[model samples]
Target: MPVTIPEIDYEAVFQSNPSAILLLTREFDIAAANRSYERMTGAVGAEIIGRNLYEVFPGGADPKKAPGPARVRASLERVLATGRRDTVGLQRYDVELPDRPGVFEPRYWSVINAPVFDTDGRVVMILHRVMEVTAFLTQLRQAHDHGITATPAEVEAMEAEYYTRVRELQQANEQLRTAHALEREIAAALRESVERQQRFVSDASHDLRSPLTGLQTRLEFALQDASDDPQQTIRSALKDAERLTEIVADLLELARLDAATPVSTEKVDLAGFVTEELGRRVSRVPVSLDLARGVIVDASPVRLARLLGNLLANAERHAFHRIEITVAADEDTAILQVADDGPGVPAADRDQIFERFHRLDEARRSDPGGTGLGLPIAREIARAHGGRLLLTDREGGACFVLRLPRSVSTGGDSG
Candidate 1:
């Protein structure tokens, strides 16, 4: 009796594949390859079909090899014998193609393999599915080849073995660049935090020391007076105690703000906020407002108010008598500028003034804090809200501009 052939879907095999496909007989001859396979390998039906695996491009001379080991023939033969599948990294091989510029270069492949069965249910072919991972592998090869420990000959051999992988190399470089930027930012942030902490400690120490010294003097005088100075001494001691308590309170507030790193913001009108904020400064220094109404911003009202309030306080402390305030919002930003008539920031000190613990020469006259943490804290808040604070050096006085983006602003424009 004759054996009947079982129906198999040939169209679902090589021809229907989205990727390159091929069919090879048990003897390692190309029975067929799909259109994608031809395009991927840059080989034709006439050249590849009916050809032995090694006959066309033995030893991987061509850029793409038909499902076989280019470096180790013995291993591939074993896979064929066992009718099994495998995967490899960075295999340098070639396929014969029409000569184009630099056609001599060996194309590398990241590949996987499997076994195909015949109609008789016996293993008849080895299948290959390859992905190009050249760019990434190229960097790995270069890093390995040029290692500090490698001898010249070893380096030469490794380079010789290196197959170019542009994509992987570019990807790795970009990732490294991003990581380096983050590292630098983190390092700068850490340095700023340390300096701010130091300033807080120093200022508080000085504030405490003054009161303590005064208390000591009062105690000594009271001792000599013997009951005559009791009232004065008690009052002086109470004053010193209050000063110390205030210092402690300030320190606690700083610590609390730092501990709660990320704060939520509510959408609040910028114009109204500025108007209310400026109202407090009313006439202490003549103030002008050009606030555009209906512009809303996303920020913890408390933090944003603190930021604004500090700037206003600075102006009040330094201004010759008048301050100008303006508010505006563009497509994606809300801008607020405050200018005063005091001695403007000198060009040399503008950059350093924002640094934690940095104080301008004039800043000391306005604030004993000369603690220099206000600007830094303001900056931190701006960044947290996706915005920034910049100081402009103008002749009339120092103008400080705060830029808040739409992400932080709720009422930008109605249209």
Candidate 2:
């Protein structure tokens, strides 16, 4: 007769293993632990399972033992990164006493961290094995003191080696922290960029709806032969189409500015530039100019011209009889003001007027051709040039002021 042995239960073997054992996820969360581990740490299975490994065994305040946790973390990280086994010959990791709150018991450990690989040879989890060596180390120290088995020099050498390893682990831990901080910053910046893109899309869709709907309605009526004046209907449809085009163009310009593209700049004579720009465009409202000499600005000529054009167009729309343009300079600033003797902006609407696609009730009633983007575009140009545009209080009508950083004077009389 042949004797037979029953098949081994591997789970039971792991649970009953003589050494302390913990199974951890790639993220260092405790997936499971054996009974020996529970006995060694003086913690229950339910308390540590599904928690972070470090959270279960945090670093103690003792300066001598502080590096123990860092060493363990570094070893685990190395095992994960290399998919190979790593051994920490000695460590003084302290565990909290189960019965005593905030009290820790000094413990010495010999640790082995190994990869738990799946069928595809990918490391799925870490198998952390530890042996408590406090008694062995204690015995060796006692023997060294009493001239027994070990010498004083041997014990000193061992301690020096342990501290050396701790220093290396501490350095690696600091590097890991730096890398994590950089990752967080990059993630935050990406999130903000995505949010800005979302807002831009939302604003574009909202403002485009009105003109699109009007164009669709007019075309649908014209196609149905419901119009008494077909030619007039066609002209009105063309006008709506033109307005849609302008809105789209303005939106694109804003998008370009939002992308933070660098602007080209050169020194510009403020008074001369204003005179040249005003000469190109004739305003319906009578215009007066008060030009001051030696006002220079570092600016992009095309963009500055657009800013001035927008201000003039806005003034022409609202001015009842007269518009005044002024150019002057102070110690560090070049100032330009465009004032209109029209009904001044309401106190509540002054700031809102510079928001994209915002228009006042009076503006809608006065100028149907306005796209409501002029003031916003002007303000953006001003900001892009390292300047600001603001509505200042005036006795009558609205006063739009642009202030830019003044450049070194290339002195000349006003052109």
For lDDT, the strongest prediction is: 2
Off by over 4 Å in 2: 1-192, 226-228, 408-415
- Rate residue 250 of model 1 by lDDT: 46
lDDT of each: 0.69, 0.85
1-415 per-residue lDDT for model 1 (tens digits): 9999988887766676776655666676877778777776677877788997666545344424433355324334545756666445455565444686334445666656567877876677766566654455455556646656766666556655553353355346546756976999999999998996787677667666777898898888888887666777798799777866755654564565667677777887778998887666555778888888766778899889878876887788789978888888777788888889998887878888776456776787676543455666677677777888999867888899998876542534633
Candidate 1 global TM-score: 0.52
TM values, all candidates: 0.52, 0.55
Candidate with the greatest TM-score versus the true structure:
2
176 in model 2: Cα distance from truth in Å?
Answer: 7.5
Candidate 2 weakest ten by summed lDDT: 406-415
Residues 240-267 of candidate 2 have per-residue lDDT tens digits of 8998898898887787777767878899
C-alpha lDDT of candidate 2 relative to the true structure: 0.85
